[model samples]
Target: MGWFLGLGIAGLVVLALSLVFDGVLEGVGGGLDGLLSLPVIAGFVSALGFTGALATGAAGAGAVLATLAGIAAGTLAGWATWSFSRALLRDGAPAPRGEDLTGTSGAVVTAIPAGGYGEVLLHLAGQPVKYAAKAAAPVARGAEVWVESVLSPTSVTVRPVER
Candidate 1:
């Protein structure tokens, strides 16, 4: 009982350390990728120690039975931790790019003189952003426009919307 309790406390300490040194132990398993990450190891140890103590103290189980129960619990905990971490680290859709802004609609924020630059308000990745804009024909401030082409990182060629 005493040893089990001590192990449980030690496991908790390791878990705290894992939080502070996240990703540091990711390479410890060499060829295992992230399967043996700190969080997974910590989950296994904590579950094993705590479950062993519970089994022995509450159920009056012998050492062998307690240890087996602890192993089963620990395996489940470790697998759960691994799965969750992998899901979080998985990549999602590629980020929106400036080229993606082409053909998108916007409004003139400042009047654009023919063949000169002004400002337009457009949505990039669902967020409103201002860009330096140029057009073949003058566009008045607050006029609706369509982005014709992205000229640079911070500028675009636009055309006034007829309607």
Candidate 2:
């Protein structure tokens, strides 16, 4: 009973530290898989063991049986929690669409000769993205431009801005 309690307390301390520190257990495993993780597994086993032992009056064989049962239950619960969290946090956001560039203002990164490809930088999702660009007329580097159309996933057609 004392051992189980001590183990549980230690495991909880480790778990708390791991939460505060990003790389507390990076070498232990590549990622946290809940109960499969060392700290989580230890915490589950100790918590369950102590509770089971206490409920069984801390007796001999009954205490052992209860501890084993607790470990099993904790493991299942931990696994379920981990899986649910992973699913809930899954990145379901779609990638930026090419059509999103239509009418957006940008600047030429490379000079675009008439009917030829160069490069233009546009702000999309708050970040600069360079795209292959072609202009109806020659556009020099640093010239202001606007996306006229999306030619492909990685290319676009632009027109020089009047200003």
Q: What's the C-alpha lDDT at position 108 in model 1?
A: 94
lDDT of 1: 0.90
**Candidate 2 residue pairs in clash (backbone atoms < 3 Å):** none
**What are the C-alpha RMSDs, in order, of all predicted structures?**
3.1, 6.5
What local distance difference test score does each model get? 0.90, 0.75
Per residue, candidate 2 scores C-alpha lDDT tens digits across 1-163 of 5665665676677567656663445466645444355445545655675566565664554656867766776676556655665677587987788899999999999999998999999988779999999988999999999998999989999999994
| Candidate 1 residue lDDT tens string, 81-158 | 999988887868789899999999999999999989999999999999999999999999999999999999999999
Worst 10 residues of 1 by lDDT: 1-10
Collision pairs in model 1:
none
Which residues of candidate 2, in runs, are more than 4 Å off? 1-80, 124-127
What local lDDT does model 2 show for residue 133? 99
Model 1 residue 157 lDDT score: 98
